[model samples]
Target: MIKIFTTIFLLIIGSTGFAIADTDYQLHAELIAKNTYVFIGKKEDFSMVNGGNILNTAFIVTNEGVVLIDSGPSYQYALQAKAAINEITDKPVIKIFITHSHPDHFLGNQVFPDASIYALPTTIRELKTNAESFLDNVYRLADYWMAGTEVSINSILPLNSTSELIGEHSLRYLFLKGHTAADLAILDETTGVLFTGDLVFHNRAATTPHANIEAWLLSLDKLEQIRFNLLVPGHGEVTGNISPIKQTREYLTWLDVTIKRSVMDGLSMNEVINLPVPEQFQNLAVLKSEFMRSVIHRYPIYEKTLFEQIE
Candidate 1:
């Protein structure tokens, strides 16, 4: 009996150690301007591993208080973000704008108690119905150690077809259905900066798992009509002018054409996976293998001719 108990104890200890070994956290903070800053949480590159660090969280701050763009994946991340923001400014976070309902974008919302939270109506519904599964998946599939912990999500500010003015900026909420039914972009007219959330990726591949490829392509074109001096993407670095937006449009166009052709030709998903990106898109940061997988996962719905698409 003593031997059996001793073995179980050793196994438990070993299991605990393994869990700790699998978790890693790193946060990056950059000041975009005198009054605005962007904080990002980085995890280990998991493209090589089956399920490793795969998501990043971004925060945007202003003088009145802080307007959190997307919460990180876990409570620890939320805490880290709060601490980082405190270092930048002493004001309480006034509002949190969830770009969508994705767990990575909103799970860390638990950290802020004094803020009014805003999200699309669809996002609020999705969170109510799917937050449980979302939390479970993060715990099971995420590479970070804090995935096993529970994250609290509270207060849903749902916007159907309206814009909110915060401070000197008017946050025009645009409903984009492609990436997720409730994906939103925060357009700041004061600085001509568009907080694109996940609508565009600066240097990395855009995640399209829950995206509508056709609508996403069209959304890109619509964004081009709007003028913005800077774009704060959900992932990768911030971009200037309209070049990155144009590049995203081009890539989506190529993806729609290439993948649709492969699908019609009876090519298996694996074959489509091996398709090479166009030479023009080779220079974009998100076209690499890791981001390519994210794109391929949502390849089926994105059907359109390259010529019909614009850059």
Candidate 2:
């Protein structure tokens, strides 16, 4: 009886059995390429509007099994994502690669406890320091959807940084230090899909609470040289062309320059925060709020630099 009722609830949420219940998090997925699928999240922060479904998580169906790029926000969302993957294929998820230590990317680690979860040692270390606190924040912000969730650390992540084989598929791992203290990007050579975790936000303004803008810009230059036909960003819709990366580059560059200019002018942080949105970036998703967040994150460093120059 409970199973039947849950199915009915899932159908009502338009999950078609992908979602476990009609909780606040209603996960919906779409196929971006052959054997490649991604969950489209709201281009906003974790809030009631989207119910914490604000990060893109993807999986590539392989001949041997399924390979999940990053888990979703909570244990419940991970369960929903797993169900969604099952809806498309019967293969059990054998390997999970974390792109970064962000809460949205790894909180669902418990759902795939049986699967091998992989990440850089740096990523694992960062998660070790911040995972519990980040999980607590998520639980408070998205309480209803996070009722049964808890942080699950991947003990195997520190084993190595070498590339792994998923059946016959070869996934190349690139360790990058931008967007966060430790960020890893993956390229599925079989499908030509590059999963750039938090490093690139398509149409949405990126959250830079943990970013090194200079390092991020350098990473962008390297990303431009990657040969891929499809890009599945950490947030926003998937794209066939690399325009999204170029667009992200523009926004990041603009923010970097704008912050420096504000500091050079000796402008107060409030002044920088209140600056009008750039005409080029006005149309992007979540501009105002995210721009302010970026200023708040980056202004301190610039202010400190100015103080040193004065002294």
Candidate 3:
């Protein structure tokens, strides 16, 4: 099975200009708060080396059972996460929350068959629409690690609810958008920890393939108002302050302004792609590549809007 998938992966990625490398799959859960742990992934893009483990997945242990934040990129990753969770506690995972439809965040849904996997209703709609394409892409990028991985969801979490008590933790669900059409931010009211999903990327460039910058900035504002002791971003390291929220806001704000300015300046896509990144964002992981991607994803829309204004 592994060999078959690998051969197919090589063929698909080769055609799509992807290259493979190597990286270990070992995962360790870092305890961020009392009874709360997070498995931080690399602050890099998906590669065979990282095997698509480029997003943070977390868990909280409560008296009833364990609550998992996101599954992960592949079955292997979920297995590693489960093993890591077991090392710390023997509690069974009773609930799983998928923050968004991003493949790296939810591909491992099959691994937790018993856990009640919940995604926002819109998130479920997105997974239903895009899971197959996402699966194909991950297989092409991660190959053997993606074996047996398939899109799976057991429940749709309504966006209307404000909070729910599971185990000893009171989880407040924030249904907001900007990162995608449906993004779920989970706040552990009991632990004062906020899992901001992909809405906030710390020390890493935010991806905008499905981004609505205006909406995203609004979501950031909402997150800023929420008081939390620690923030676990979908990517990057955990922080005790709202620095991540501020950083994401700054980046998105800059991206929106820059893109609009460039379009109005009549700059071509290539020019925008090669433009120098601001000094502040220079140190972000995958800064250049993600910026380039954002340009490619958003430039045309900006161009179209400007054209419409003149028309």
State the C-alpha lDDT per candidate. Answer: 0.66, 0.82, 0.88
Candidate 3 lDDT over 87-178, as tens digits, reads 88899988888899999988877878888888888888888899889888988887766766777754545456779998788999998999
- TM-score rank, highest first? 3, 2, 1
- How well does each candidate superpose onto the true structure, as a TM-score? 0.79, 0.90, 0.92
**Candidate 3 residue runs with Cα over 4 Å from true position:** 1-24, 154-160
Ten residues in a row with the worst lDDT in model 3? 15-24
Clashes (N, CA, C under 3 Å) per candidate: 3, 0, 0
In candidate 2, list every pair of residues with a backbone clash.
Answer: none
Decide which is better by lDDT, 2 or 3. 3
The digit string of per-residue lDDT tens for model 2 on 1-311 reads: 44345335555666555444446466666887778888888888886445579989988888989988888888778988999889999999988888888888888888886798888888888888899899878766765566467788945466365576777778888877679987788887877889989888999998888898889888877888899979888998888788888888899889989999998988888999999877878888989889888898799988888789889
Name model 1 segments beyond 4 Å from true: 1-24, 41-63, 147-151, 283-311
Off by over 4 Å in 2: 1-24, 154-156
TM-score of 3: 0.92
Q: What is the clash tally of candidate 3?
A: 0
lDDT of candidate 2 vs native? 0.82
